[model samples]
Target: MRTYQTLTVETAGRVAIVTFRRADQLNAMNRLMQGEITESFESLSGDASIGAIVVTGEGRGFMAGADIKEYAAQTGPEFDIFQAAGMRMYAAIENNRKPVIAAVNGFALGGGMELVLCCDLVIANQFAKLGLPEIKLGLIPGGGGTQRSVAKLGRSRANFLLMTGAIVPASEFVAAGLVNEIVEVDRLMPRALELAEMIAAEPAAAIEGLKALTAHAVSGDLDDGLTMERDILGELYRSEIGQQRVKEFAGRSTTKAKKGGP
Candidate 1:
């Protein structure tokens, strides 16, 4: 809800569409931009009216990466401050209660790719190019890309892409399981919203529980993850919304099994 110089949030139905508004800079992640992102996700996560979120860039690029000019001259503490801000934002997206979708329209590199990886689902334009090329800059992806990418795409491919500084096409991204779907640039946002709306239709409690379950499974002990999932799912099933939906589904199944007409 707060005004952001580098970001914009628009509500469509139950979905909150968050756009990185710095197309002029190819949507680079500067300190101010990163701060806005952190604030945006934090605000959206607690808003009851918002059931889902779609993050995208304003124009040609999703995000080119970190602002190189700013990075070129940085004291050690300043560097830490920069990395911390970005990490905070990406982590917020990963742990958001509602589903988060990335509609990557164009170049998504380095920190940009890390941002995409934080999403629950990724939908990119066919022309969108994604990579983590920080090694080429004598740097590394400090925005959680190292962990997230390998978890999603396996260690070999993660190493190849990050080390070689390869820029992969959207098709390759889909094949690698990095992105869920790819479409024309004009259709990217529509597809993202479609997915978001579908997710939003489900009970919020179940959605949040599943999100936590998957994230925990990815980063925690398997036994603990499974236990938490079982407990949370049971709680969801007992909730009023979940019970109503289950009853509705049962009624439909019963009607289908019955021979008599209504």
Candidate 2:
């Protein structure tokens, strides 16, 4: 229920919508904003009422990247501390128990794009542009931009983007499997909520298991991944909620058969 200087939180049913409210500065990640983001996700994880969280920016941009002016004035320790905090925000979202969706409504560059890369799912607007333009500023993304970007988009594609600092359309991200879908500007939040709601409809145990197993699957080898998946699948199959849903589904199937439906 608490509000932060850089964020606005609104709950729609079981979904928490966290929007970047720093519109005047194009929602750039400053020290306060990054800490707020990490804290928000940490708090939301403890709220059982909120099943999922959607992160987006206010106004015409998701985030124009970190506030460049602030970055220009940082001393050695200041920059290191800020960078660590920013990484924590990104990691919090990436490793959060709840599913975090990125509803990218505008340009996401540099740190902005890195934030998107850390999210569990991304629903981007058609006109949105995403890139890691840190190289253009005589820097490189220090916040998982190299590793996470490569994990999602593969080495060659991620390499080209990072090397050239190219800002490309959302379509290219979809092609690279980075984005889940593209939507019209007006439909962005609605579609993201639709997906969030659908995910929330499932049993929490099943969803949690999936998130854990998938993370393990991606990070570990195939043999270990398969074993972990098998363990989760078996447990979920025997869970009370799972059995209840199966019974209801069976009843519906039986009724449909009696009615001569497919």
User: Candidate 2 residues 190-228, lDDT tens each?
Assistant: 999999999887787788778877777666898988898
TM per candidate comes to: 0.96, 0.95
What range of 10 consecutive residues in model 2 has the weakest lDDT sum? Answer: 211-220
Writing each residue's lDDT as its tens digit, candidate 1 over 1-262 gives 5788998999999999999998998999888888888988989999999999999998889999998888878899999888877778888899888899999999999999998989999999989999999999877799999999999999999999889999998679788777999899789999999999999988888888889888888779999998998899889889898799899999988897795645
Error of 1 at 96 (Å): 1.0
**Model 2 compared with the native: what TM-score?**
0.95
lDDT for 106 in candidate 2 is 92
lDDT for every model? Answer: 0.90, 0.90
List the candidate 1 regions with Cα displacement exceeding 4 Å.
260-262
Residue pairs clashing in model 2 are none
